[model samples]
Target: MTQDIWTLIVVILVFLGILALMIRGWRNRTRSQAGLFDSLPEVPAETGEVVLGPLTGVYIGSTVAGDWQARIARAPLGHRSAGTLTAFTGGLRLDLADATVWIPRSDLQTVRRASALANKTVPGGGILVARWQVDGPDGTTEIDSGFRADDKDTYPRWEALRGDAAPTTRPDTPSSTTEENK
Candidate 1:
């Protein structure tokens, strides 16, 4: 019949182009695991902290350091009491904790946040960022670390309960320290 209808229309156009590339690669891996589990928020199990913003994006948790002693020896045999959070998006380098958070499929650049604040009586306060710029093999590493949501005396009890509205004007960068007890 016209050459079997042109070989069944070229095998149904190569099986609909391989089923539209496997449904666009399973909808881009379910939208990249739902954007890394919605960038992990709502973290406050007594003080795992994570009050707000751009918070749970960066995640490294471990690389060498014996992978943090095998995640603190599997955290009390799974009772749950381990911690880790190393981050650096695009260029690659993420090893979170509380149970996995590694992303490196290629062409990254997603961890972006600049400011965040939380200290409403420190039931696990807040702060968040994952800014990145690194080059492995011990060369370049520029990560501005400031992710202390709960621990560390909850920023001096949130600046002694924000007495003088907090700011005593002193930002010359030395990790800025001028706590006149409010």
Candidate 2:
């Protein structure tokens, strides 16, 4: 009887886990696909525009009630996937394992430095947050690009493309004093 109870409990837990994953996936698909319009026109990348990485393996998330939730991972039972971010002369492209997003210069609103994304904190101002608009099912809506640089060297080019001044200083790097102390 005890063995049977243990099996039943294990089955129940597994079922709950699956349910949670399904819910997460459904929510993620809704948010990401909400802005996809088949009629939206495409813009071509300009010549001589710098390509700042296929910054690989970055976590992408969306905002919900003013907080960020990572969409889903491309693993079993999850729909969120690691994505690549590329900045070019005209705008930014986010290539996910399952989909791709194009944010043109006209659609861009602002780009700023950040220290954290989703639920994870990235030390230093290592993240580049882009707030932009896209064509959704309901018309235009705003979206945030939650990205952290794996290669710091690419930041200047990205800033320039965003038409923002190169930061006078960056906070994500360890301070000289902190380095000395260490």
Candidate 3:
């Protein structure tokens, strides 16, 4: 009888532990999602120098200026880049590449020296924003997306791309392949 009671106690403890773990996981997920939205600041139209936090993943679309438009030609990371960004309505996964760079959306923290602040009409209209290009270990990828001040939700995507965990700064020296390419 005593052994059965001990077994019951152990089972109860195990169940309680599992319940606690599940609650903790839910809380963390909620916090992370909330942080994604709360981190963005309101950008003004006239703001010129907007700095961006790390990007969750580099965009893979092409730039469009006036009549010309660019689309994502190829994604080495797969059909989509392995990252997340804030879209006009909600959050979106930035899946444009094949190698799948895992940039967590919660990393973008700030934006500075951005030209988009002065151009209020640039979000859905106006000149195409500058093309964002990133050279990774395999090859280079480019995206034709512009930063929007009104969409603060994108901060998490930006953070994930440019967070401290990103590649370390390299010296000004060019790589041997770069020298050859030149």
TM-score of 3: 0.22
What would the TM-scores of all predictions be?
0.20, 0.59, 0.22
Of 1 and 3, the candidate ranking higher by TM-score = 3
Tens-digit per-residue lDDT, 69-181, candidate 2: 43322221133357778777677777767666667766666566566545555667676666565554645544446666567667666665553322221232222222112
Better of 2 and 3 by TM-score: 2
Go through the candidates in order and give the clash count of each: 7, 5, 35
Worst 10 residues of 3 by lDDT: 173-182
- Candidate 1, residues 17-77, lDDT tens digits: the string is 9999987864564443231222322222232232222223322221111011211111111
How many residue pairs of model 2 clash at the backbone? 5
**Cα lDDT listed for each candidate:** 0.29, 0.55, 0.33
Q: After superposition, how far is residue 127 of candidate 1 from its true place, in Å?
A: 3.0
Clashes of 3: 35
RMSD of each: 17.2, 9.1, 17.8
Query: What lDDT score is found at residue 47 in candidate 2?
Result: 24
